[model samples]
Target: MAPSDYPRAAIVTGADQGIGRATAIALARAGFDVGFTWHDSEAGAANTAAAITALGRRTASSWLDTTDLPSCAPVIEKLAANLGSLGVFVNNVGIGLNSSVVDTSYSDWQRILDTNLNGAFLCLQAAAKLLIAGGSGGRIVVVTSIHAHQPRFGFGAYCASKFGLDGLTKTLAVELSEHGITVNAVAPGEIATHLGPDETRHPHDIPRPGIPLGHAGTADEIAGVINFLASPAASYVTGASWEVDGGMAQMGAQASSHVANNDWRQATRKGTSNGD
Candidate 1:
């Protein structure tokens, strides 16, 4: 098949369910062959591959443990070999840890950081080498979280990892742009997924009543942003974190009110007073 006839190949991580699964399907429908990774979800990954095949696109699934870097390299190498070329890489594998900084154990923090930040770094490096070898421009989209920018009360480890990812994304965009590789990140807030409860009053759930849309966003919504970033339409966009939240991060007042109305402003004033 001609290059035009053959779909571009994309690799999506953590694609068994949620935003990652939706992104794989979206890319396949948009004329991309897909390879996705899932950990301990063979049935779900097979289902995703079946759906992609139904779209008349090629699909591959592999077991991936992001924290296990040595094991990850071979999976990506095999994906590139099978797919003929790797044109897009989506780093969607991540874990959330919610605990106060003092309560967060060293091991837990390391695990979250390893999976969320270090894992993505490895994948990006592998994908970059493959793309460079292919001599074709590539797209790298990272699935970060709104917590990358906004700090949540009890999610210290999660926030740190995501915040680090945001920095990585920006730096990669700058370094890779000369190679025709565009790197970007999407930060979603209060998405209804396995990471958090969808109900209004779950103890572990962050109440999103202050979101301008007044509802939890769907994984598909977040996937839409990833899809756009991977498409030709976003050719000029890079090094940016597109927030998929329903104005959650923009609502500083609401976030501050959870503690005290005046506390936020007072804190801000103190920072300003101290030349911060």
Candidate 2:
């Protein structure tokens, strides 16, 4: 291994595919033994493990259903045991909802909260305990959404959950700083992972003029930031949220998923359309 590479153990939740899978593999490449948890598809989790093994890194995986909040702690403990120790934990389990508050059912709201917030709390808490006991200091990266800081139409439940998670990220950062655990959040805008028939395609060639970058971000893009956060290079960074949008936050506009018009592509100044 290179002098910069540290042989450690890292765990990522919800690695069935997309950003979580990308993160798990990236950490393996960074010289960490990886343990990942997946939900929905066992095949996808196997694929992730296979990729990590192909990298010549140690890997283990287990199932994770974030809606079952009580199940989170045990899964974390099991993964930590399988990996030998925990130096990094990426809290990457989340589910989205597409309904306004008035249109949302109680069940849907509860499920979103249980999965995205309550379950996440349990998982992070469990991981933090293991890390603190290890006494080696660790990294905790939370995967939030651009909605964590902004609001979107028809996504009341999801937005609320992410907002709460963002707050949790900050709180954990401060609380865990003393234990040498750096806590951070990665907030992604619309990524191509869920956009097309080829769901795994990155930066799908779709016309999304609403974003300054003119396209959606990719899972790998988000994973790149996460990989950095989990590394020794980012040892001094903590309690910060990295917004990985394509300049959407600067425009203060909706994400690509909520934009249907190309009007946002142009700049408007004092009632006059501006910008080339």
Candidate 3:
């Protein structure tokens, strides 16, 4: 295909693996020339680029430390230059912290916020400038988590960052709608990626009760939601967060399952029932 014949262009942060990789490939398959960023995994980034190119879409990969605001400008500039235009931006780069607030050091908190929240803002700003300059309007998708809506035991920092990102998505949607740019967030839950909890699980292992769907999600499933948002069909959609979490967000009934651990339970007619 001629260079000009390529559909639109997209940049996916953290595309070295997991949801970011899947999003990049999905966009490529949807006719977008894809660019992606990796932090410390050049091999993984190369693999993602190769996959996109295999789909007959142009691909560009760069090393990006999302925590460093100064490092973002060049990555965006280089990708936009190579892709010829910027039509979509996916804020998928983030680090998860599995620590309690009490145990999380100040540096750890800052690192999480810097990478997950501040970095996303910087990226959106850079991409928005290009999209506004191009005057074509564009899609901005932030890959949040189910924790954005609910807190978890060991994901304090992660949940906070995701919540912040969701707020950013809504605010940006309202602000950028006039310019025709759409801002939205995809909150995924229990996606079975290398970085996911299910990565080391046995195939026969039972699904977590927290997920009402009875199974973990896959990266491609989340990517499908993102792809739809990036498409023209979503032109009327903005300021929304699609919970691509397979009903996890709606499983308010799961709270009853936690009663199994309660020690204060009444005795049944025949015997003492400990609930569980």
Q: Compared with the true structure, what per-residue lDDT tens digits does model 3 show for residues 1-276? A: 121321399999888887898899999999999988887577888899899989999988888887787888678878988999998998888778667788889998998888888888888889888878887788899988888998877677778989999999999999888878889999987766653364576422647665667777878898999999998888888999998877877876756665466432322112110000
Note the Cα lDDT for every prediction shown. 0.80, 0.83, 0.80
Instruction: Name the lDDT value of residue 207 in candidate 2.
Output: 64
Q: Pick the candidate with the highest TM-score.
A: 2
Clashes of each: 0, 0, 0
Weakest lDDT window of 10 consecutive positions for candidate 1: 267-276
Candidate 2 lDDT, 221-243, residue by residue in tens: 89999999998889888999999
Q: RMSD to native for every prediction?
A: 7.5, 7.5, 8.4
TM-score leaderboard ranking: 2, 3, 1
Decide which is better by TM-score, 1 or 2.
2
Among these predictions, the greatest lDDT belongs to 2
What is candidate 1's lDDT per residue for 209-265, written digit by digit as tens? 667777778778888889899988888899999998888887887554564454332
- TM-score of model number 1: 0.86
